[model samples]
Target: MHFQWYPGHMTKAKRMMQENIKLIDLVIELVDARIPVSSRNPDIDELGKNKARLILLNKSDLAEEKQNDAWAEYFKEKGFSVVKVNSKRGGGIKSIQGVIQEACKEKIERDRKRGILNRPVRAMVVGIPNVGKSTFINALAGKACAKTGNKPGVTKGKQWIRLNKNVELLDTPGILWPKFEDQTVGLRLAFIGSIKDEILNTEELAMEMITFLTEKYPGVLEEKYSIEISEDSYECLRRIAESRHCLVKGNELDTNKAAILLIDDFRSGKLGRITLEFPEDYE
Candidate 1:
């Protein structure tokens, strides 16, 4: 299936980010731990040039532990102050302040030399929709300061949040680039629920997911549903439908319902910690 979703509002969001980039001292970018490279917006690199950069591997808890460590090191090697965070549960949120200070130490020192003191580091929290930007901000500030939802486009405008005396955050709506040149990136984003499901073919998406799991994480589905695995993804999905009792009318397997259930299980971590992309593959 062809994967693409860039609503008109995203264009406006991109413009707003461009206008605000000049006011930011640091760019705190959140990327999904499972697909770090795919979830990142390439425009951010261009817009945030010369700014202190931090990459937070949000939803780290839902991804493999080893992959999470590898991704953190990968970003660190690229000069981003990396932190593995599970914002939903406050994991790794406490260290953010010190990391932020360290990330902007150069700016802070320059300020001190220029007789400026205690000016809060202004950071722009950004990522594609549903990658947990608002949730991370809420976790960092220890309060629900930004609006959050599981679906894309939940945040429509910008909001300035005072995180503390030394840090202020600008939360912007999630924006995807105009087009995904590499459809693989688009597919990964869709797998992670970054793309809205309304525009996707759930059965096809689930089949793709089945293929991935069968190759990368064999036996996971079999164990989860207590069904024998099949070489054909559609057959596997059918088994899942039967195992989960997803049926229509009398006894026809409701593969659509099963597909939704499977996707939801993967997103919610019931299918176990899984990472869709690896750093080595990108290299």
Candidate 2:
């Protein structure tokens, strides 16, 4: 299946990020834990160069634990201060303050040397859509933190959410677009709902998802759908149609409907916490 991306919106998002990056001291990047590499748009590295980087593996609860550890180590090796977090449930949220301080330690040290003291670390959350950036900001800042409105010298209408005495976050997150030049990366993004559904056939995508699950997860489909696992993805899809009673008319199995159901289940974490690609799988 093929996926189409709008270059126009991407260009706009890049421009916005470039403008916003200049106003912050640290970039708190969020990546979908299930597809860490695929969900990320590497353009942020170029746009946020020289900024203190902290990568939050958001939705870590929906990913395999061992893979989460590997991804943390993977980004850490690339020089990002990485943290695993389940923003929805607040797991791993407490560690963020400490991690953020550590991630910006260099900046804080420089501030001290230059005789600048007690200046809060300014941060901005950035991520591709649906990677849980909004949820993360809310989780980090809570509801009680008031918006520090535009100041005299700062840009008008840019709100700063004071997370604490030592840290303040930009109220708006810097949006980034996922790179789609690589077909494999596009496919991975499509698999995770980062790409639009209209661009790809649901049945083909579900079959591909089943193929991957059968190979990597082993028996997830069988256990979830109560159907025999088959090496042929189409056959497995047919079994899902039969088990779920997905029918078009008069007992005719509706494989398309079943495919949509399977994909929906996978996306919503119903099929379980499944990570499509591992950090080791990255080039």
Candidate 3:
């Protein structure tokens, strides 16, 4: 399926990141644990070059544990200090301060050598849309510091929240790169609700989700819907509609309704923890 999702504000957000990166000591990037590679914007590497980097595998609660460990290891190997976190529930939030110190040890030491002492490390939180960046900031700050929403583009502008005497965080709006050259990347982003659902065909997106699950995660549909699995992904959606009584006109099965239900269930973690990309793919 063809995929496209780029809002005008994201362009402005990218420009903002470029202008502000010079003011920060570290870039704390949040990536969806389930789609670590897919959720990442390639431009961050260029935009944040020379800045200390930390990667938070956010929404760990919704992704497979083994994959989360592997992705963290993968980012760590790439020289990023990595943390697996469930931002919505405060998991892994407490350790962030210590990790930030560790990630920026060189900078902190440099300041000390120059006798510029006691200055906090300035960090900026950034990620593709709807990847829990705001929730992570709130959890780390131990308060409702950033506006929270499941929809993409909720946090409109930058806001700085001082965490303590040693660390301050600049929260920025979520931004997607200008385009997604790879359709798979776009699809994976869509799966995690990083892209707005209303812009795409829900039925098509759900069919792709069914296809991926049936191949990568066998029996997921069968167990979730209590229906026999089939070779065709469309048939699986039909079965889900039949089993769950998604009907129209008193008799006709509403596959579109079933599609939305299945997608919602996956997003809510009812279908089970799933990780779309594997580290081995990159290796």
Candidate models: Cα lDDT each: 0.87, 0.88, 0.85
Q: Per-residue lDDT for 1-283 in model 3, tens only?
A: 7886646776787888877787789999999999888888888988999999999999999999999998988998899999889999899988889999999999999999999999889898888878887788778887544432232332345456778888878766456553578888888888888777888788899999988998999988888899998888888889999999999996999999999999999999999999999999889
Instruction: Tell me how far the alpha carbon of residue 189 in candidate 1 is from the true structure, in angstroms, after superposition.
Output: 1.5
Candidate 3 at 147: error in angstroms?
15
Worst 10 residues of 2 by lDDT: 171-180
Candidates in descending lDDT order:
2, 1, 3
Which regions of candidate 2 deviate over 4 angstroms?
none
Residue 19, model 3: lDDT of: 76
- Model 1, 1-283: lDDT tens digits are 8975646777786887877788789999999999999888888888889999999999999999999999988888888999999999999999999999999999999999999999989898888888988778777877545432232332345566777778878765456553578888888888998888999999999999999999999989999999999899999999999999999998999999999999999999999999999989877
Give RMSD to native, each candidate.
5.0, 1.4, 4.9
**TM-score on alpha carbons, each prediction:** 0.91, 0.95, 0.91
Candidate 2 pairs with clashing backbones: none
Clashes per candidate, residues 3 or more apart or on different chains: 0, 0, 0
What's model 2's TM-score?
A: 0.95
**Candidate 2 residue 203 C-alpha distance from true site, Å:** 0.3
**Number of the top TM-score candidate:** 2
